[model samples]
Target: MNIKQYLDSTYLKTAQQANLTEMENTKVVQHFIQEAIDEDFKLIMIRPDHVKLANDMILKHKSKVLIGTVIDFPNGNSDLEPKLQQAQTAINDHADELDFVINYEAFKNGEITLIKTEIIACAKLALSNKKNIKFIIEVAALSNHQIIQICALIKNTIIANFKEENFANIFVKSSTGFYTTINNLPNGATLETIILMLENSNPLPVKAAGGVRNIDDALTMIQLGVKRIGTSVAKTIADGHVSNENY
Candidate 1:
């Protein structure tokens, strides 16, 4: 596995605070972000409030630093209007991509039409800025069968929408940090989910996240067809042995 490609393809997230006085904590977070980018990370995801700081770093480094902002992050409990507002705000702040969580309960409740409508609305919001959208499925919450069904359903629906909208990519993502069970696995079901999605998707990219802590793990997920990794452990992974390795 090529380490540089994996590093460059990842979307690293940092701890973010909502205000300027929280500068110290933001600086600490940015430090790790800088180290990862120095080692060749091309994208970074952060909370909306930290966009200014991240933008500053992106300008300073003269690197291809893509800024991604989460919409209804970790959990997808917000109403459609609020989520759209968040997406618009992130775009207004210059986010290159939007990581939006799908409202799974709506889908499982047989609200497929409604779910599609919501996704379309979000997709349109993102498209208005010529920004890309990655839908987080939170794979740990579903059975394997359910996961496949969701993948097929969304791939058919959302990818078509992206095509009709003339955007290049509509991504399917697995697990947000909200699912702690994945954290317990020796190696997560990240690769497994990506494999399933790839087998089922048309051209949508897959983001395999949650507990991806080292080079081997990241590369393994990538080999299984993941185009992006959402993580905070890039430095540790990029530097260490990545096998029987100590962080």
Candidate 2:
């Protein structure tokens, strides 16, 4: 398979954390954007703040690589309003895909209704704008049953509220790649988690994020039916280089 086509070349760093001036940070984003266009990756997954930069560069080069941004990234605890507003801003900046972090904390607290309402609203907003969206359930934070339950809920809710056909436009993404695991547990997508996700959210597609650091692992996820792989090391995997970054 052409692994580049399945890769969502990603770079989601904060300005302070990266220790670069805002302008310099954007230059780094542009570098990844440029690389994606050159390597023909499936899309560029970045922070919401850099949507315009990536969009402008894609337009400038007339590249087919799509622009994707995160919503309530790393943590999915924001209220419905902020999530909607953020989604709107990303759409305005021409993001072709939006990856949302579902509030797993709320779900753990037995607030399934709140979680459902929030996801539906965001999904509708993105769908109405003709943009694809994915829900990052943060598998490392949940049990296998929770993963299955949440995946089914997202798939069912979207089908019931929106056009059932549009279910294909959405994905049940595995991890944010920012959540740390306890006792050194896997922090991102794993074979066991992917199996449960595929069993529960089969038609909805899955994006395996984190823990896929090489070509063999990426191809294994693909062979198991993951539609997308979100990583910061897509080029390394394609070039068959060694990268220590887990994500």
TM-score of each: 0.83, 0.96
Q: For model 2, give the 10-residue run with minimal summed lDDT.
A: 155-164
Give the per-residue lDDT of model 1 (tens digit) for 13-70: 3334224345666666587558656766656767777666777787788867677777
lDDT, candidate 1, at 238: 66
lDDT for model 1 comes to 0.69
lDDT of 1 at 236: 65
Q: Which stretches of candidate 2 lie over 4 Å from their true place?
A: none
TM-score top scorer: 2
Please report, in order, the local distance difference test score of every candidate based on alpha carbons.
Answer: 0.69, 0.91
Per-residue error at 111 for model 2, in Å? 0.6
